[model samples]
Target chain A: MKQVLPKADTERAIDSVFAAARGRMPGAGLVPQIRARAFEVYERTGLPHRGMEDWKYTDLRALIGEVLPLAPRPNAEALVRAKVSAEQVSADQAVKLVLVDGVFAPELSDLGRLENEVVVRSLREVLENSATEAIAGLVLSTTNDSAISLNAAMATDGLVITVADGNAVKRPIQIVHVATGLSVSTFTRSYLQLGKGAHAAIVESFVPAEGASGYQANDAIIALVGDEASLSHIRVAADASDAVNISSAIIAVGARAKLDLFSMTCSGSISRYQGFITLAGEGTKLSANGVNLIRDKLRADTTIVVDHAGPHCTSREKFRAVVDDCGRSVFQGRIVVRPAARKTDATLTTRALLLSDQAEADNKPELKILADDVTCGHGATSGALDDTLVFYLRARGLSEKDAQMLLIKAFFGESIEEITSEKLRDFVTAQAEHWLQAGR
Target chain B: MALLEIRDLRVGVEDREVIRGLDLNVNAGEVHAIMGPNGSGKSTLSHVIAGKPGYEITGGQILFRGENLLRMEPNERAAKGVFLAFQYPIEIPGVTTMNFLRAALNAQRKARDQQEFSTPEFLKRVRDVADSLNIPQDMLKRGVNVGFSGGEKKRNEILQMALFEPSLCILDEIDSGLDIDALRIVASGINALRSPKRAMIVITHYRRLLDHIEPEIVHVMSKGRVMKSGGKELALELEACGYAQFEDAA
Candidate 1:
């Protein structure tokens, strides 16, 4: 019989977390048991490495070096300092939920200010109540992904939001994660459930507090859309240059439901965002799009998996990456059509613009089809700026830099146009423009 | 004073010399038609004047309004009133035609220290020019020259020429893919922009474009140099007598 070896470096880091979480792990009844089981799963697999097919391009073991200790629950004073101001995220009217260093900051949130018929609760508060099913549902997964397990074992607090049946929330929900000046690692998990025929839009921003450095954040969100429901999700990560951010979104779409997911990674020392989407019922539609503008020595990765399990469903995925200086960008997309899913239509396209000789881009698109009478395709391309287009713009009187900038913005215009909301589209475009300017 | 003076111009692409000892001069208000064969270096001459890359000016002097044109960048040449209507107009996706035009206009204005046009003023000007050129309203909203018909592209080039109002205009093979109707429309648009201060160079392999916008002088070119120079009737003579005789005369 083969004998198990001693613990690896990241495995020991997990052991330390497990030891530290002994009595402080928040949950009632089965919650602690679930957390322990999850930690066990992570302990067995350890941090994902280059050998894993899913993590082939982005090796966390190699990139993360050694895991920093889990962030402690913020003290009152530290919470105050870590709270992200409303003006810092957006001036648009939104239902704000604030999390400071992985702990719920009620004083910084707009709980009572919400006018819509929406239910919002803190995950920790719900974990202690008889909401055992809700807690279990939040952590339940078809696959025991190591990252999700790690988040479950260590997450201190997050939000639990629900839009009741037939409810259409007028204001978007804004969940802002703020890390204070302390260089600490944090884990957070959230759940969003929409009842039948419900509609809502949520914007999640990962922002480090002013002067914060060397922080690491692991976040996960589980969203379930019921029949005829619609959800718009936008995630933007602008962490500190020395920070590492890992985020995941697991979404399930019901019959005739719609999901629009858009993400942008404009700043981070190293960041990876994974989106797992499953069309569970017939006639559902989804559009998954993203943009990454990275510069300097930063690295960004966008990995998406779209599963079409329902008949007559459709999905479209588009991503654009712009790398400057010594930055690196990676995009991996997989679209799977199950046997029961017929007449499924899916398409994916990813393009990268490398602005410097040292910049790098890796794009991988895969499709697995088991159903007949389905249409699915994907394409990827990476190259330096188009010299002909630059010359064309220059011949019309634009400077070289200005011409390159114009082409870069134009390259991202397609993905931006997919956004349904005008204000959000403009905001994202402005964010892209800001990234471009910072690199210059 | 000459608007453009080319003295002993020699240009090469990579290793081979395309334009060998070419010389031509055009005064303000005069239109010069350069009739050439496929490899006569007419297009190379236009690109060199517009300051395109990938070309070595081995030995030449290209003077535009008394400035060394070769010393300027492409955008600088454009701001200084040199325009080239390319034989193949590049299709730029995701850049609306209106936006492209506005950016170009404003950049040129900024370089010349002129006040930029207001949005409404700019819109009105573009609409007027677009309407005059029979450009559909939808075309202005789409990407520049993306999915445009061949004739539409040629007309768009002429529309740009009208808008920039450059002092020296070089139209390189502008009539290659144009039908009779398109050729007539493009030529009329060029004729509308003709002024005493604006000189024009029409480079073509055929004489059809010269019918509508007649030139004051015509030069038969071969082997990178002008083999013969005559009046506007020179084009008709070349049409009657092919460039075979002049091909070796250079």
Candidate 2:
């Protein structure tokens, strides 16, 4: 295939976003530095598409082909109110950080009980209010990826959740980064920092606000699990039928740390979620599972990279997808074990269920082990529901629909059961069953 | 009074018929053993009676409690007191035995318009049933039939039958892959479930299971048909003769 330039419409759109990003910068401590660096990278990389290796199966070309940022609408307040209220998990239960249309909605949000051990602040506000040293060392130092830099430059207001050493937030934190009505392009940069011995479970759910369309949401969530800290991040997305949601999460699990990431992509037009986790310390453990349900010619891609960089570290990754009605789902999971990472046990498995003959699921589970003492394996499987099992269920007096629903429920529940929270567990299970009922 | 009446039953899987015009009946409080060689349709009789799919009922009438049992779906039959101890039980991962058993029991109960049981009440009931079958309560917490030994799987099946408490139980080779101790335990469980109102059909290749749970009638099946029917002595005669009479029917 020939390398095609950005579509004329998209180029104009990107240029307009760059001009707006440069013009919209509010002078602050770290803003000027990050914004300058972001613009440098933005000019170099432009917007990555299917041609890039990491974006190979994603084909973001369809999403980026039309460059537009949804303009902030008049009903932004109402949309933000509904977004937080509509969360399946109660706002009272989550350490809620509500971002409305790329800016923190303070009046509509609740950040409760934060002492020295915990800190809940906004990215833009953090930059404006942080001590100069903290702004330079902490805020401006971490983001190395081009996407994060790009997001940092254009992001208006974002979340900054920090935990001091040996502190664990009792309740799971819920960060709802919602893009409300009509945006041409939106950039979001959020960060989660856990110090040593800290633990937290965070759920980041992004649902397109009602009637939001014709836009690109370039999202970057950077999570750092410090030594002896354990964190679980659950990402859920329900994109509008016409909207394109592109998000990436880069997580680094430090020495003896643990990170568990679970993601479910329910409804989307073209969505790409990439997870990059670095098992940085000996005895560190990392596990990631993604369940993607796609329909109506929609395409959802989940790409994960797990690196066992420390000795005695463990990594497990599993991806399951249900594709139907000409929908396309792609899962590319890679587990890497270094030569020094002895006793590193890593496994990757991708199981896909194709509901329609025209629907397709492509899974590539790859393992690259440079250590001889490591135990690593990878497997990819694609199949329909077992006829024998279906017959067995129907024989027991279940209708065809009921039997398939039960089986698909059981099939998807295998991973959902691994979720630690019972409340979230039941909610996701019911959601999965509901999706099955919709036959999507 | 006959609790179960199978008249002119003809069944086939795919295109080939397996149960060829087989007729059998059982009165309340009676236990009947259907013995046959491999492919003799002993299993098919149990599955077909339970309404398993893929098997066409070209000609058959199964009357249970004066109702057309063949017309009922499998779970309906189960709800109406029909249980089949599977020859090969399914392995359901991530689903605990207790969870699935509770669901099955509750499903049956719901069909009967019974109130649902609380978790504690269900556990208490399950414990008693498990203890009687020599099954550990911990087994219920494990995934359904996953990684259980052959004997353990069969015992789990009987445990389910015991818990469900169906009217006319069908044991399809419950003794097939069992050790002596397992076979005795299985037969004892069946014996424990026997009631005057609850009849049973024990399908097997050997008569060893009948030793513990005595059957009132024994029938030798060959080529999808019952060739001989007699008392317990029939098992002894078949054991002595080694199925020489079965070759004539083929």
Candidate 3:
């Protein structure tokens, strides 16, 4: 017996991604079997285009010109050494979760049981031995994006972190995924499971090894917050000059659960980072923030889709982007409120600062609410820095460069200061200050 | 004997001269008021003295403490005992008043070979200053000049002056938007900082502020230069009738 999946836009988007992949190689037997199955599902629906309300500004077609291969794993050792921030992890320290050629590197992982309330290990271990069905049932390899779909097909190892019920972990677990070695397109995945009433914080940092770039790294992550559970998650992307990252995050919040997610994207050649959040249970709350500081010709496209599925859920999102040179920043955020999800309160705001005349900011905020009792709104604004502010700081004894640095810092402060850890806060602040001081 | 001496000063903005051949000298601890009509180059003199950008020094020599101020950067001039209380303070969003002030004070302190104050110590000192001025404790926590009332801006100027404590303070239109009570408090704040080693230049269009600040000498500026110099009584006389004489001269 087979189950029938609903004919939703999400399903169509997934189908289109498969079609894009299936046409790349006409294979025989097993290759076509897998490709056909994926393509059939994709044929029923296509990837969301700009016409779609959720994908109004982000034109995936423009970015998906050619399909990348999912072969040879990334060089884990080289990437780990180059991309890792010396400030964050000591030369020899850090519970590193290396993804060599897109495969999990257990030899580099450092994790231990804390108070017997949480378990941290590689995804391969959980896939082989974890008894809980939630861990297995929660993993979805099929996504609307072809790159994500490829990642789903090729995901062999990832980070598997679980928080037990009624347990609060004070120490922040760091997950560092490096792409190095034989650098063909790498498909990496991260699966995070949270138990009821469990509280924890995690920082997912991604960087490419010395030879990292021009290759695609399609990655997916799932974070399940159980009832009364809390989570503070941050995702940092500091890739090399030629790397392209297409990362996705799917979060399901249980009743009365709280989730705070801060995403910092500073350096990447071309990154299409997407986040999908589902308010699955009532009384769930979330504060999602995004900050990106891009210079040169790098491109960072951030798209977020939040679904208000349950009643009495509150979700707020704030995104700020600072673009300079010829870099382009794109933001497409959508909030969907189902009829059953009444009393849902949500707001999305995207603000971009264009430093140069050539720099461009594309922002699209959408709202689809069938519930009359729901409160959902979104706004987007893009502008250059105020000359008055620059002059004002200059008059206060700051040089033109120093004054611009201060103004940029202030502009990006709303998002950076959202990190709860003072140490981490200072670390990111220092990174931003360095970028400013370098005259970027 | 002179704290700040301007010799044959000529300042211009965008190739247009604003301060032409202006001369002024203020001895230590002296309060000089530069009173003029709206376009008489009052603010230009303050900017020229503080080394603010956009104003080209076509011809002038500004000597402060026996050093050429025109050769110094804005912050350098600020560290060299020169302060300018802006007529309209810029609103710096996300930068708290305390943080900016602390950074400024530390930058000045470093230039002066002094140790920087720790966060707690700095907070204590600021709290004490805020207490003296009856300012709300949380006001310093807010973004600089953001959403502040006009009078509050003037008070914040005084607050910055107190924090920096420069030797020569040039306040441009500090009394513009202040109320009588605020003016009195601001005047007191300035008077409290007055010492034999400090000099102040107060710019105002009305005599009401002079009544509170009590300047020793007055310079009546017409067009781009000082037309006459008189005792403090000139402010009262100008208040009684008007600056008709000066306007006619211009």
All candidates: TM-score of chain A: 0.96, 0.91, 0.83
Off by over 4 Å in 3: A1-96, A113-115, A125-137, A141-143, A437-440, B8-17, B56-61, B113-125
TM-score of chain A of 2: 0.91
For model 3 the local lDDT of residue A418 reads: 73
Cα lDDT of model 3 by residue, B12-78, tens digit: 8887888889989999989999998988999988877876667888887988878888888787887
Give me the candidate number with maximum TM-score.
1
Candidate 1 TM-score, true structure as reference: 0.97
- Expressed as tens digits, the lDDT of each residue in A58-170 for candidate 3 is 55544544445554543444545544432244222224455655666665555442346667666656555652444454554455654455554445567777787888877
**Fnat of each candidate:** 0.68, 0.30, 0.45
Which candidate tops DockQ? Answer: 1
Q: DockQ of each model against the real complex?
A: 0.79, 0.37, 0.49
lDDT of 2 by residue, A242-277 (tens): 677777888888898888888888877788888888
Regions more than 4 Å wrong, model 2: A1-8, A25-46, A63-65, A73-92, A113-116, A127-150, A210-215, A390-403, A421-427, A433-440
Give a tens-digit lDDT track for model 1, residues A335-369: 99999999999999999989899999999999999
- How well is each residue in B78-143 modelled by candidate 1, as lDDT tens digits? 999999998999998888999999999999989999999999999898888889999988998999
- lDDT of model 2 at residue B249? 64
Q: For each candidate in turn, give its C-alpha RMSD to the true structure in angstroms.
A: 1.8, 3.0, 5.5
